[model samples]
Target: MLCVRKSYALPTIILICLTYFLFANLPPGAESPSVNERTESPDTPDQANDGRLHFTKKSEKYPVSEYIPLPTAAPSPIPQIQYDFPPESWWGRRQRVKRQKAVKEAFTHAWNGYRKHAWMHDELSPLSGDTRETFAGWAATLVDSLDSLVIMGLMDEFEEALKAIEHIDFSTTHATQINIFETNIRYLGGFLGAYDLTNGTYPILLKKATEVADFVYASFDTRNRMPQSRWEWTRSAEGLGIEPSRNTILAELGSLNLEFTRMTQLTKDPKYFDAIQRIADEMEDAQKKTRVPGLWPLFVNAQDMSFPDPRFSVGGMADSAYEYLPKEHMLLGAQTKQYRKMYDAAMDPIKKRLLFRAMTRDGKEVYFPGNIQATLSPGRETLEPQVEHLKCFLGGTVGIGAKVFDRPDELSIARKLTDGCIWGYDIMPTGIMPEIMYISPCKHLESCPWEEKKWYKDVRDRLAKGAQLEDLTGMAKSLIQKHGLPPGVTQIADAQYKLRPEAIESVFIMYRITGDQELQDAAWRMFRNIEKMTRTEFAHAAIDDVRDPHTEQLDYMESFWLAETLKYFYLIFSEPDLVSLDEYVLNTEAHPFRRPTAA
Candidate 1:
């Protein structure tokens, strides 16, 4: 039994009108079809005389053009969404500035606490003023917070963090199996981000990024090009026993493109690119073999790349895999057709197979992607029809990719999915969404329909007396088959809210893309709830249960709470132009990397 590197983990944000302006100007790829290539060519001469006049004989003053300009035409005529809010009076602007400052203060408060008690550790236990190590004492929180500190202009904290980063000895190797996904996003992603932000002001950031990436790259030396989710740095490839039939999770295999690709771009090392790209290649192979068209099952055999679990989700095990599809394309300036094609392929199936539009108990229509169960028989799959707060990331991911790819249909999906997520928050008693939610299939209780839905409700009614979501599984073909819609979120299992960032992350994107004031207000409400519940004398801690705002604290403060959650909250309320999404593509973890200026 090898020790896995103990680490606290992880998570995405926003759009801007100017982002469209910049992205629209990017050099087109070879396969780039004009936006209107699918539409009428509009090359008719004398439109009224040519019998092209089906609509009111064409305007006399404003005749239809013989040729419509290309979709990439300069200065888009399409209207952009503007942020709706009170007038920017001096006082209003002053309060907005204060809000930004308050977020900075929250960051500083967490930073100071971490510095005093957990300076070289992964995260802080705010309740007890103690430190904990994750990723083998890598100071993950400090490194992850570097760019945020830089962004917020905490020069002194940035200097201190840099000093700590400089002294980090990546030469120390460990036999503990580290989580490749967590290490890459929080550590490698953080360093690359800080490095790019400062224009290479501190090469130590790159040095550390390369070091960690090199160490992790060892895990990819697999026969099937699927890296183990866990790795031991000391022995690198040789340490972890090579089980020919070992299964690897999809998220780990699919989420590394941005960091690895960025490394290649910065260092001109094709090996770094090749190491991760092989996984992408393997993904292309796996999709063809999997029963699901675009969605891959959660578990795939590392040796043959065959899916095992028959279950697919945009949740814990598989969330970031699908998340990176469009992002990889955007990261590389949509020049990588593999990424774009993969993304396009995944979106439709995800909507058709995994997604469901369920009516809440309160009669609101909520569209969510349920976990899919693939059977031996194709097209006979079942759905769990529940939503995880973690999966809230899908909305923003969809929204940003839609914006980049010029897919208005996908943007509509993004909006509906985001609205569904907001409904999750609204239904929670404490005004903060729970870690898991069951979107009751009951459009009407009088119908008492759907075997899964009925069983779920019965199980919950019984559970009110005392039962577990995991325990109620004795009646079906197998315990797994016994599973159904989760009894309407029976007891909000895993009730604790560990300062997760997904909901706010999507809100940030929604506000930027649609300029929807309601999302902004929702974000504010969530922030105030978290702040009110989690704030402590030293620093903030994760609350035990979002269901009960008064529930005891969890003592733990995940680094992402600082890196992503609060950062997004601050940005959602800030000026949209601060860092336009057009010029930067965000990694799955919400670390923004500069998009290519050229094709």
Candidate 2:
């Protein structure tokens, strides 16, 4: 009797559950409304056709109101300089178009070679068709070349590159250590520039950029929040202790603001900006305390954030630090005045102490920024008459700074510095500047003559350290004949041409700022010479010596060859409005970050 009652009850319960479940999730309009419900009118607001409730009306008790805007002053207007750009008759529209096409073809040739041989590597060994993992095997050339592809209207190649970018896991790399400065400028700058240029159409780039920023941000984990310029990521990941170096290179430490600030602008995360701003504040406070009152040394004591080294240069160890000051001011929309103040303070001393005229055989009026050796006394500082191809970037830096800051004197100085670099390329047998060289200095900046007696004296002083007249004379003659060296050029310190972009970088800036057609012609000649010398079956390779026209090709090609060098070359031929200086600020790597409009 109990079993019979249980079975009957179970069947009754099952039938009741089925009936309830069937009615609960019926399709809309399948079931009729309850008797108490009223039909919704078409005019009814906040009513969902799916029968879900929504609160659309504002609450009477807690009314929302407009918020006050943040206070900000409008940025000063950029002075309109009437540039003397070559007219169509002078530049010739057909010739301009033809040059542009040639540049595009060159880029395509190199890019295709990279794709075929070193698609996922840091660099392509153009000579051997091999790949090198110079930067964590991160496909550096691909990321670095993103904006260039967009600028050149190479959408097909850009899309193909995107497929590789999407899979890059920046958090983990084969590289045991990474250069924070290089990573920031090349990868972070490249990502943000591509993102801004595309107007947020590609969110993946920003995602990748954030990943890279986060990865490098770990290097800033210190008591002072100063980053480790050369970060050992493998050790850091393994929970080993890592800290900022006691001695840090100025350019490596200070060149990070531009890229990190841009990251903050796009992501709205202040951590990236704060990390770099702390370094900037440290630099600003220490600016006047250095051995040279206004200039900082090549290396700084990171513990105290002081300039302990007496060597000062606008070259390798210190180039981009000063370059970023005015650019950061521009990037921040000139709202921050410290960068402007820092730039002005630094430039005054740079112009007065570092710049010197080179006594050319042709007596061309040109100037180069030389390194300084600070002494105990301020006036006793000595100048080293060595110029670096890297320092050629100063020409463009000052040119744009002059226009932005409204300094006409600096503009003239900028032209002379640019001409100095062009002279370097022009005099070289391969028509490419050497990595570093020594030159004869002019006593006067404004006026210089080819002092034949002074030239011989310098040669004798340099070569007569321990050698006899025969060896010295033979060495001097060899320097003049074998290298086909120009007058004023004393020695080729590093004769290898590493496919550097600084010379053309300045030329592009000067062209944009002054609209000088002569700069365009100069850049065209430079491009032709570089293409003829460096071009390989796979891609362009660095040469063993610029003094030898048939110089042997080095296996490695730097990522900057495509990123900065070729991009600058391509933009020099492109229309001015494509990446106008007024509309964008470029990082040291030639990645263009769009400037904010004045409030």
Pull out the clashing pairs in model 1.
none
lDDT of 2 by residue, 439-544 (tens): 8899999788888656655565554545566655565665466545567887777899999999999999998888888999999999999999999999898888
Where is model 2 more than 4 Å wrong at Cα? 1-76, 80-87, 466-475, 482-484
RMSD to true structure for each model, in Å = 18.9, 16.9
Q: Which structure among the candidates has the greatest TM-score?
A: 2
| TM per candidate | 0.78, 0.85
Quality of model 1 by C-alpha lDDT: 0.68
Residues 477-581 of candidate 1: C-alpha lDDT, one tens digit per residue: 232233322224433545667788988888888788887767877887777777888888778998776666578988888889778988888887687776556
What overall lDDT goes with each candidate model?
Answer: 0.68, 0.80
Alpha carbon lDDT of residue 195, candidate 2?
A: 84
Q: lDDT (0-100) at residue 299 of candidate 1?
A: 73
Q: What's the lDDT for residue 297 in model 1?
A: 83
| Top lDDT prediction, candidate number | 2
**Model 1 compared with the native: what TM-score?**
0.78
